[model samples]
Target: MQKIKIKGQDYQLPIYLPDATLGVARNLDSLDLLQVGLEGVMVNTYHLIQKPGEEILQKVGGIKKLMNWSGFVSSDSGGFQLFSLIQKNPELGKITDEGIVLYTGPKKQKKTLFTPEDSIRMQFALGSDVMICLDDFSPPKANEKRIRESVERTIAWAKRAKVEFEKQLQKHGFTDDNRPLLLAPIQGHNSHKWREFCSQELQKIGFDIYGLGGWPLDEQGKFDYSFCQKNAELTPKDSLRFALGVGTPENIVKLFFMGYQFFDCVLPTRDARHQRLYVFKVDPKNLNQEILKKLTEENRLQEIFDYTYIGKGKFATDNSAISQFCDCTLCKKTDDIAQVSKAYLHHLFKIEDGSAFRLASLHNLRTYTLLIEALRRA
Candidate 1:
């Protein structure tokens, strides 16, 4: 699909949504996001419900109003966060067919059940354009039996989520053409048989989009491109696919070719805060399908995408801008004000200045958006 229509608004596909886990994208605000050319953001349902609570969101008329944002927002089912918590501490919670059972409070004795229905209700309250169904996350080291259980539970929860989604649409007076899009993730780890089963079952239940669930990593802990390709094949050619928590620029380019059009990852912002900056080796103004195809065919995508560790001591005296092609606040120079150079950014980081985070984030976000612009043109 070249584009997706949400609530009657048209947005181009192969879009990258930065993670705004708890109603914010770390250092950047909504205006900063728009300034960096981002059209959408992803939020975590579980986190928002716990912090801001549902009542506050309803009072404020949803997250968009609360954040003063006027762009598309996608809410994740929050299954991944819960899964990680429970995995790290078994006493925290447990996943069942009904939903996730949590042990909260000081003694871990307080019982709270987060069901698939609840996830949908929360996303509706948040007024997300795209909402994901809660699914059992497959841990990296999951075995055959664990994989089977995850797939089974994922399908069961998806059925419940779909029911809840329809109820909300009617209650909110949203029609088929203007309703929010629901997405269900397929989970089965790396097992082809189980992955196929998960995909088929989710397809039967139906959703506007299909997500590539579980960790996209191989035994060596490297990105598993073959697995992503297989998952994309599991869905129809025309069906929209979301690469949840998907990755670096190179990964996005490869997955876009494999038919995955939607992406969300914390990499850009997270890396920015850690002093890692992404830059294009060559100007992307000359990008096209032919060039992209040739680069992929020759496995030369790595050449175009480069990185800079800005916190390094070597950059303290470097007067160069982060990226010559970047048009972010830090990179743009005016007659009176000078562009933020590597030397200044390095000094800011060394002094632990808060502006360092915001400036770096702006630059990094712009880099990602520029890549998206190129992909859209191609």
Candidate 2:
């Protein structure tokens, strides 16, 4: 496991950060996140500017202050959000080397230029512990030419983002010891050649961390481990890598051994809200490096990892905790009071109660933290 300091706070590697896209992790409050043992959260720079807007964020002294959160905060460059919007409907905007040109207003004629420099500046204003550079995402089925163009643009943008990042550090009077970490995503779709090239170029510009950019899913929507493995290899042995938007419990455990130390994804919390909760078939406390390695090596992760869909009919009358291993509020009793049982949680969801979301989210996130605990030991 790796350990690093961000803005004077300590963080152990192989850490997971849930997405709080707009400075909030959906139904849960900041204290709830801390209670679940989460070390940090990833916020979106794109959505924040659209919602609370920059004026309010700066006035309130950034997201940490705005949310009254004390945990580490990582900010997305907002490049993916813009790219996704344009990809869904090209008439919305276009990607130029200079930046993403988005067409706003009723007629879609009003133009807004969102550049790499703008992303860094906004993230600094948000006072994030880790800041990602804006990058062009390569589509899975992108042609050879398109993939090459994506790599070129990603490298170019990373260069500009680095310049802006340094400028911001100096402006804010931050030193190397106290400055936030900067990450640049490597975009190459499935092409190892382009991915390697992107990595080499970004390394020359020298980003603090390299992100696994683009979708790791194959054309058939299956998770592509080879794609992730190749991306990890592109960076140096000791370099830090962020598995951006990567999935599932199995994915996290598998990727951790492959040399990725940082991860941020929406699966755990999102799945909780959707009534699908993750659980370990065996207690995570029983896991260790040798056992986990044996399971990974023998392709037995499925045996140890599983999920509980709280909405199922069988769960409607089940009185057990969501997970026997989970210490979340819904799973663990407080001062001998009975914890919320699976049956009660199922009823909460059945009746459309908002507390169901919060309770489920807490359980799921706790489950993730438990896994993180086991991995750190590994």
Candidate 3:
């Protein structure tokens, strides 16, 4: 019932798990760093079930109160994990007409079964703002028989998740004022025909949002962007289209132009932890001869940075201590990339410093939030 509007656009933010360890706590902390651009945080159902257990989270006032975050939150059903788990240990889990049965953890110690109804119940317990339906996924090279089986099961699961979510909402007296939205995922491998079939079928099932175009892109050593675009075209325009698990900056730009409204991935945060940052130039000439000279002296002058540097190896004009391009707090506050230097970050990896993780997480989050803002303006 609590209607959460992101960026004043009547849609939810698509930021996925901050990371594995901290969960919602990390997301809440990043909000300060993200400022007003922060909208929603996404959590993984499979990961949460393994670690904290949904019961514990419910006892702690659900994810939002536990993290003390008021914005929208979404949870992915454990479908993808089941698929990936099958790859690792084919015998680790079994799929039946009803649902999936799997073991959790390194020891393969605990056995748990997740039906579509069960997946919905778990999200309800977590009090997610959006609950995703369970869907079967197959990699690009999946056999025709396996792909057909998975797609059929995925459709069945979507029906179950939707029915259960509606029943639970009614039982709990959920209204537009405080009810969460439900999303259905479309699953099909590389085939355009199957992709269209899945999309058309799921659209009739009726969900507030839809997730499209997932599965291992690297198996073929290149992405099938055309397949993705075709699938996107098949989806209904009234509902939001989310491109799950793919959020490279360039890919995001391309997908946005292709009509995707929501995206989530670990690239920005993961890359920042490895000392990669995204920079954009307001004035091309601000990155002048002097800044290039300093960067050359430091051996940090890459062709990529040539478009953005202002001086002293700093990025973004606001961070230059002399110009003003970005208004982000990190750039406005100080010229201290040392506060989050590549050298210190690399040192952290070399020696495994916990502080480095925190810094990298912070900077990466900032980069993602800023990028989303920029995209919206454009």
Leading candidate by TM-score: 1
In candidate 3, the residue pairs with backbone N, CA or C atoms under 3 Å apart (3 or more residues apart, or in different chains) clash, namely 1-177, 1-178, 1-179, 2-177, 2-178
lDDT of prediction 3 = 0.63
Sort order, TM-score high to low: 1, 2, 3
Candidate with the larger lDDT of 1 and 2: 1
Model 2: how far is 77 from its true place, Å?
A: 0.5
Better structure of 1 and 2 per TM-score: 1
**Model 3 per-residue lDDT tens digits across residues 278-374:** 5543432244334434544464534322122122233322223221333344344354543333344455555766665455555555555655554
Residue 154, model 2, lDDT? 94
Error of 3 at 161 (Å): 0.7
User: What residue runs in model 1 are displaced by over 4 Å at the alpha carbon?
Assistant: 335-338
- Between prediction 2 and prediction 3, the one with superior TM-score is 2
Residue 320's lDDT within candidate 2 is 80
Counting clashing residue pairs in each candidate, in order, gives 0, 0, 5
Descending-lDDT candidate ranking = 1, 2, 3
Stretches of candidate 2 off by over 4 Å are: 334-338
Best-fitting candidate, measured by lDDT? 1
Per-residue C-alpha lDDT of model 2 across residues 175-241, encoded as one tens digit per residue: 9899999999999999888999999999999988899999989889999998899899998999999
User: Scored by Cα lDDT, where does model 2 land?
Assistant: 0.91
